[model samples]
Target: MHRTWAIIGGGNGGQAMAGHLALLGERVRLFDVFSDTVNAISRQGGIKVTGAVNGFGPLEFATTDMGQAMEGADVVMIVLPSIYHEEMGRNCIEHLRDGQIVFLHPEASCGALAFKKLLVEAGNTADVTIGAANTLLYSTRIITPGTVDIFGVKHSLYMAALPASRGTRLEEAIGSVFPNFTLCPNVLYTSISNNNAMMHPAPTLLNVARIEAGQDYFYYTEGITPSIGAFVEQMDDERIALGEAYGFIMKTLRKSYFDMYNSGDMSESDSLSALCKKVVAYREIKAQKTLRTRYVLEDVPYSLVALQSLAKIAGVSTPCIDAVVQLAHGMLHGELDEGRTCEALGIAGMTKADLLRYVS
Candidate 1:
């Protein structure tokens, strides 16, 4: 059967996904509330993809109506910012029909868990399955209102359904679309294995002065120096420790990047600078034009803070992660600690065993 896919964001990832699915001949209905992206797609007749994914992906329909978008859809892929997951989940709950799957593309560190809680609190009774992708399948950007530039496609992506039981069916459905994705134990592995938490924040934070100075440099190639690489490795240690505490084996940034991009030989001693030089893809990725990029605002709050929140409960002291989170708030000039925490995710009071059962 040709399953219907309703992509619920019009951002870069959403556009790229719509293009990929439509290119593969899947029925697609894309929706966005704020941006004119869906509207632009309707006007343009299709969403165009350049660079790596080349083709026009037809949208069977595009809309801002939440209900209309979800009508008869098999899978609803929520590809929005982590902070908006709850609100989006709430909006989709009532309209989502039975047996529908809500897959968060790149859960940005346990976004699916928070979204699941929102679904429950919203009194959702439908037999809907919820799952998450550890990271997006592509490095993409909206080249224009109705076009996306896909730089690269991930070779391996992690996904898992909540409660662990719904994974196999969800895996088959998604795998039919994207065979690159593989199932993990659960969303905990998906969340903690998010490489963005390892790769994004520190490089941008360390390059804040350059971003402010309007330096014309490609972020990965020119920004991620040896010093930054060493710092990121330590940051990875904090994440790995936090995961180990919970009995999940998190992928190191080296292994994660290698699996995703497949161009770097990141050995134990290979610095970020060396890995950057080896990966040809990094050269095209430019630094953020401004200091207020998602690298800090999004990553710090949703990624690092979420990690530290779990780390605290797991009795792991994350000095490097904590320092970066503190530095990011200071640099961004706001209290970002109000991001998705254990308390916010309804896991603050649970013991380790209880937490395992809750997610399991």
Candidate 2:
């Protein structure tokens, strides 16, 4: 059966997903806020992605009109900035119909819950299943207006659904698009497993002098030296502790790093030289910089902020994460505390007893 998939945010990730879904013969619709990008996709039919899979075909539709793109979509994949999820959710509440499934690719916090709040505020009670993840499935980018490059597609993409009652149906819906949907126990574990939240802000804040110093930086592996990696690992340890306190066995950031850059363990390559060799191989295979670059700017606010909330709930000290949060605030010239904190997201104010029942 030919299914319909709408990819929100017509940037690199959206385009890459649209390309793969189209390749699977799904009716793909791509949308973005930028009119020029929409026009470019419309004119060129679709983006041309290189590596792993290569093909070009006319997108079923390309538009800046959210209603038009979502009116009949069976599955809607959102890849926008985390800050924008509320606005997008509001829009979706106004337009989403019954039986449609909305997927937040790498939901930072409880995006499904936030989105559900929007739906309730809109007085909509439609049975629209919402699913979210801790991280995206691929590292990809658009080199130009209509060209996308996928560096790597993850082996497993973890996800959880709102209400916890809709997880099975949500999994089945997304599995239609990508067969690698691994059902997480819930959103908390998925959120904790996100490595970017811990790694991104620390390095970006630490390397601000360099990033602002006008030197061209490479991938994250470039900035993550021994000492920096240790700092990042410390933050990751705090996150793991928070997860354990909350009763979720979250994966360690070091293990996730090994999966991404090495062989999933330092013991596999005990020396810095061996790790460097693995990093070189990672760079040589593919070099798309959208998600890799946004990890700091984007993940810090959403993911790190959530980590801080979890840490507070668990009574775990997160000095490193706190420092990075402050540093990110200075770098962005805005207080992330306003929108990135638990209280800001309408969750921190809840007591532990309340949170357990809520997320549960």
Candidate 3:
């Protein structure tokens, strides 16, 4: 019996997951909010992918209707942004049955915990398992509405569960499909492990003028020279310090990038420089001429802002993180932290003891 996998969002990430599962002969269902995107995918036969992975073919299923897409799915991968996870979880509360596992990609800032809370709030407590991938497996792009180009899958992707008891079972479920998945100690590690909040926003926000000025640039490689990379490393160090103060083990941004790019056996310096090369190659292949990546739009509120709150509770000073957040706000025109903050996620106002009580 083949397990059915449902990937929501139907964007690059969703399409890539669906394509992989379908290719493996699993039943894969894809859904998105935009009808045009769905129509484009269906009309084009399937998503066309390039680089390390390649080929284009038909998907097992694709739909705009959420409930219909989730029917009979053994695993549901929420590939959408962190903001949508809560509502998606609520919707699943009514539809998801026992034995189904909902996996949040990257689980930005403990999003899995919030999603599970939403499910509980909906007055439904079926034995549906909740989990999250530490980071998105692929660094990809949607060349067209119907095509996805996968850069590579990260090594050492992490996962964890709510209530801390379902970790093993959820890991077993997701591991059956993605053998590379590793179980994290808890959601806190998985949540804060996202370096995009630290790395992406700094460069994108700092280089906003250049981005807006149409100065044809590739951010990580060309825009982030030695000095900029040094600043990024410093910000990453602050993030690690915050995690350490809370008594957690967080990987450096360099290691995270190396893991994502699969640059194994490479020295630390070699690994970071390799990552720079990957970023450059990515821009060239995609013909990207702007700095409007998801680092600021997706990473700031989801990852960095969340960490800032955590640092406050842990009594850690995150000067670099703070500066980047303020800089991102100044550049972006609005406070990304307005509605979604640690408090909004139920972590704010809680003492360090209270947080450790849950995480521990």
Candidate 4:
């Protein structure tokens, strides 16, 4: 089955996905708001991918025009940060056609719901199915303009669609592009299963001084010390508890790491810190140089705050999660309150059962 892809965003993940698909002999078009990024790839005529998946993936074109990018795409892959989900949704509403599938590479939390809400609010009745993966398929970073380095590819990850009923349809449509995606119960499970919400913010917040001082270090190996990892474990527990409250049991951070990486040397008894240190993919990743990086700004607001909102609706307490949110808010000068919440996601007044039924 051949498919044409429209890849939105020109970041590391976007370039990697577009390049990988193009390398697989699929027709791919890359879209980015930044003209510089588009022109860079346009000049190169393709993305050069090295490391795990190495090849020069020639693109049909790279453009800033949304309509042109999506003109004939079967699958629209949004590979931006979660903060831009709403903005992208707005940009896509006027252009989306019936039967088009809009998938968020990593939705962070409630991304599909938020996107669907935007579409309904705009009164655009396109029969588009929104889906989300719990995380990106590749652990990759950009080496230069029009070039990316893939550190590792996840063995598997959970993916699901909004309205729950479209799960199978989404799988059938997206299977060729992401064969490793395992369909879960619904968007709630996929959102709740977001491991970044548990792993990123805690260690980043705990190591604020180093980041503020502009020191360099390995983010996972050195930043996540034993004490910091213990704090992250508490946050992960709250995430799992929130899932349980919503009738979904998610894997712990440690278990998720093992599942995604499939590292043979990982043990069931390894602590979170030990497990993180063992992951080869994370070894070369460096810590953020400043506090404004996505580790704190993006993850804190989009991921942690969203989780806190879900916990509120499910009547689940998340003290550890709350602590991080508060610390981030204070440190970042209260810039994170407008993140994805029940009201923002259009489920402000719904009960847990109502919310579950809505997705189901």
Each prediction's Cα lDDT score? 0.83, 0.73, 0.73, 0.87
Q: After superposition, which runs of candidate 1 have C-alpha atoms over 4 Å from their true positions? A: 258-268, 335-337
lDDT of 4 by residue, 1-360 (tens): 778889999999999999999898899999999999999999999999999999999999999999999987888989999988888879978989988889988998888888888988999998888889988998899999799999878778889988788887787877756788999999889888988888788888889989878789899999999999999998889888999998887889888777755568888888888888988878988888877778778888788877877888888999999999888888888666478878888889888888889888
TM-score list, all predictions: 0.93, 0.88, 0.86, 0.95
Model 3 agreement with the true structure over 1-360: per-residue lDDT tens digits: 568888888877888877766766677778898999989887866677676577774676678888888888888889987767766767766878887888887687778767766775677777877788777888787888877788887656778776567787776677776777888777777777776676577767666667677777765666666666777888888878877877777889887656555435445675343466564334453213443456676677777777877888888888988887777777655645453477666777788878867654
Q: What range of 10 consecutive residues in model 1 has the weakest lDDT sum?
A: 259-268
Candidate ordering by lDDT (highest first):
4, 1, 3, 2
Best by TM-score: 4
Q: Which clashing pairs does model 3 show?
A: none
lDDT of candidate 3 at residue 170, scale 0 to 100: 71
Lowest lDDT 10-residue stretch of candidate 4: 254-263
Against the correct fold, how does model 1 do in TM-score? 0.93
The residue-level lDDT of candidate 4 at 39 comes to: 99
Stretches of candidate 3 exceeding 4 Å from the true structure = 40-50, 54-60, 144-146, 257-293, 335-339
The candidates, ranked best first by TM-score, are 4, 1, 2, 3
